[model samples]
Target: MPDADRALPAHPFDDDKLHEECGIFGVVGVQDAANFVALGLHALQHRGQEAGGIVSYDPDVGFNSARRFGYVRDNFTKASLMDSLPGQLAIGHVRYSTSGSKGQTAIRDVQPLFAEFSVGGCAIAHNGNLTNADSLKQELIERGSIFQSSSDTECIIHLMARSIQNNISERIKDALRRVEGAFSVVAMTRSKLIGVRDPRGVRPLMLGKLGDGWVLSSETCALDIIGAEFVREIEPGEMVICTAQGVESFHPFHPIKPRFCIFEYVYFSRPDSVIGGHSVYETRRRIGVELAKENPVEADLVCPVPDSGTPAAIGYSQESGIPYAMGIIRNQYMGRTFIEPTEQIRNMGVRLKLNVNRALIKGKRVILVDDSVVRGTTSRKIKDMILDAGAREVHFRIASPPTMWPCFYGVDTPEKDKLLASTMTEDEMRAHLGVDSLKFVSLDGLYRACGQKGGRDSADPQFCDACFSGDYPVKPTDMIDKGFKVKEPA
Candidate 1:
């Protein structure tokens, strides 16, 4: 079998956390736009690490694309590859495969999924999941559309191809109107760089300006990577077409209240990025403060799980007046694709990626702050590591509420039954993990951390908290059709 057909081994540590499906970046009116796109994708690599691709449009070369399985820095950084993708307009994607074949991600599934239409050739990089994709795919297939990739993103391209609309932009608007769910798309034609967000805005898309060029990215941090100025967020239900002259904004879909993913602040986005004018790092820190206020405990030191949990740990330490220490040190060089070929290495699990600070943790009542607990396996292992390091007691404080539901909006999540919180109460989880105590910030507290002072609007939420509250803004049509049960409303 080819490399694409072979199932890639899942990193033991990576299986425990939720993953964003992909990140998208596009640039127009710049020399070698693919280079800027490469930088942007590198900045957003945390969103997706499985595969990456870039599609560039040059007047001479027409449309050129390169898709590969692995990190952006590993592939896109090659001078030869960058040279082949030269263009004034380019769009790119870093994919984690939430909507397609899971472990066996084929190169064809790697996006900036390009398709030639009657009007023109367009390549699109999508950063969210389409809830109605399966049903739409079936419908299209019955109508004689041959599928190339199993990816849900292909549904959009086919939808666009079948449209009677005269222009690519109009076809896109028409196609999106028939689809349901979250999307922040960066698409490109020969002359135009297009950006769009779903009606509910369950994903993030930002517009930036670099000299005379225009940039669209999944996060503001990608803009910063290319020295682009933060222009603004592409509003929910809006689309913008960019050219050398200027940008044109349109609300192609019916208006709906925006429900941007709340988890982005908690774990998905880079710490340095800003969302809706709030710094992601600040929001995470505030979440820590809320966690401390709601679940105060006596401990000698507050220690973060490392990386994602650091900001929240700081806030928790500050709020509780406890000394903060780096009880766990992460292996900076470890990549998610590191293969564990032996049973011994597989059993080592998180130890491959993280190590305990023996001296700091020795005899200390350590309060460990983390973003969230999914399967609880990682938490149990970490607790054992802390105990082995001579810690007197181990306590877990989660910045977000228990993730009881699986996300359908472009996040890779375990089935609901597999989630630790879905089947067990807090006390049961604490006992199961062998931790002295366990607590998660309440959903309302999470809202407060996101700057919603009055807490979540029960009647109509301000953000998407589907994983916590089991209230989905857009009905997960594909899953529903597959007989997946959604939580009943209270």
Candidate 2:
């Protein structure tokens, strides 16, 4: 079992926001594919900063693998390391450890996990979590399957090894059919690059075209990094096999309604990326617009919480006709290891990343726009900073609905009871944060921002708003077996 206490963020205030899951990218028919994979992973560094790994298949060299701790730019950019991994087919993964031994991530736990079988050598990188992993692991162990790493992704390799299928793709299909929950997988064999999305399509995986080669990435931003042309998103319950000859698509699972993760628009994805034809930046702006309309408060200035909150802050300003100001400036160079050893410096958490613009905040009734409040610690600290800078009042406007439930589909979230929204009402949260006022974009408003004009259909939600609405599309089987109760559908 993962040590939840140890899984806390290295920097104190880092835990104030929901951590991203993982990023998977793969390419075929490209020269020095590992180089491209490294660049793609770099673009996706926001998703997972803990570790990164790449696996490349060369005809002469066979399969080459390299996994490293820290950022991709630091580890994979070395000429010596990149030279070691030479091939035309490659897949890479950047991990934040939603599963396995969190905070104490071992090198083996890093992904693009490779396995050799009767069919051939195949490397697989996975993006989401498996809800039934615990049960599946126990069953596999009883049947004499030895585990390599603590990761749930290793289970897929073992299942594939035991499958009676003749090819890697068929075995993958077989293994996935038995597991439950969200997964956007990218696997590469000797000649083929394969991408698969789970039946629910809870996580993202998209296809891209690069000259004679093909690409599969978690988001379009990575494609843009490698100069790859945007192709369509990989459909739910669909698998695409990419080879030099052509790309082949297959639907190996029973078709179901797609409930893609709605939070991608709110925080997970890069603002510049586009998903399902909607720009993530535009969606966040729309969310801010909705927030401004729903909760119109008279304030002297609209200020963003910095980087993540900027676009929404702009939208809120435009909608409310409140002038936007850079009330908080972010220190982009700050990393997790900066002066974090001492308790006093640890307490000085949010200040290390963000500083209040005293001149702009002073004597102003500031309307602070932030993406979401996970624990309310950072919000409280930011509010205190604004007040200390001479702000008359601070009102918090959150871009997304309250996050009341933990995400089981890959996002690293605090326990149910730890979430501030889970234990407190809106008014309670406002009081807890010590803000003059607090309001969040409603669930219906969020759906409207995502292009659902009629708002979320309660009977059949268009997207997975489980974190906000507590209506999990896929049952968290492992959590349930361990006595974790889910919200009963209304």
Candidate 3:
């Protein structure tokens, strides 16, 4: 997930940043899987806030599902809702519509999508987007395969249902092999709980153990929420099946170097969660340290943009020997501006979300640390707020490199034309935002912060930085020959 922000009414704010894709959780061997799933989804609420759904199966009751277009706490916490879903094996999803397809926002599109086949029934919850979904959907529809929803995830269900494989797990592997792009999926059959990650591992998924039970979730934090001890991440291109007997693993794809999403360190994942064996909070702090070394600034105080930038700001202060101060305070209750639905509402979003502290920033030359700069709307508004607070000078430092390209796998990014960094240099952006100085951490520096000492090696990169560099590992087959603007699936 990029940020813990929501939109207004039915759509999210229209701010110039990325909206998170989704989060998935599944558990087997627990007597109350739905309860554990609810709590796990609550921990992952920051990943996606649009809607939540859970599907569970019991030997007697069969498969049951419940989906609602609201927060997990608001809908999944109710006793009635829980009563409606009873089972020992369960999988759940919290989604943010990544596509513009019609009915994408409808309740029917909310996931943990269920499908019944000759073999048995299965429910799947996906955490990333499939780049070749449209092409696959077209072929499937032409073959007379009817889709239940407009979501790309539904493609997996239909594909699996039509597979010639004998078992459900093999059918799943068969279905996945036909698609391209990122995915971290948790699925459930009548007696088995399954988890799989894309070959590139573009998304994240972890395995954990809770007493005698097993769990799979998008982040380790979800495991913590349910008292599940962290096992290991479900290996990239690996599939794990958990049942009452035990757990088994399979390699569904050919071996290759893994390229986990680098943004997970910059913005996604809870600060408390760990990714690729690195602490998210620590990675953020290291990013700040790297930024300070690469872009030195002499300022009275190091101020953070709030919550998201807090850890980085602390690291910057320590490295630069400057005092850290909370110069900007964010409102806890406001949603992100992107969901404002209107330009007028989005224009007022910054003020509603953050305010400058006159006492801390007054007459001070301050360095403001932020995670990244998307469209530059938030940065510009923040600079104005600092100026109004009587700050003599404002210097902006970004933790990650400029997001030069849009994300096609999952994260909802603005088109290239809408991205500020895509069209402007650092100096131009600084002038545009009315800041005295602006410096973004170098791409290599970002890699170093993620524990890659020699920095990004284009030959064999350690992680996915495609948004910063236009080197997408996946072919983006559905988007090619389209001038970088992949038409959404019809």
Q: Which of the numbered candidates is closest to the native, going by highest lDDT?
A: 2
Q: Rank the candidates by TM-score, best first.
A: 1, 2, 3
Worst 10 residues of 2 by lDDT: 1-10
In Å, residue 210's CA in model 3 sits off its true spot by: 0.9
Residue ranges of candidate 2 with Cα displaced over 4 Å: 1-9
lDDT of 2 by residue, 103-174 (tens): 778787899999999999999999999999999999999999999788899999999999999999999999
RMSD of 3: 4.2
Candidate 1 on 211-270: residue-level lDDT in tens? 899999999999998899999999999999999899999999889899999999999999
Give all candidates' CA lDDT scores.
Answer: 0.92, 0.93, 0.87
**What's the residue-level lDDT of 283 in candidate 3?**
92
The Cα error of candidate 2 at residue 6, in Å, is 13
Better of 2 and 3 by TM-score: 2
The TM-scores of all predictions, comma-separated, are 0.99, 0.98, 0.94
Instruction: Point to the candidate with the largest TM-score.
Output: 1
Model 2, position 132: C-alpha lDDT score: 96
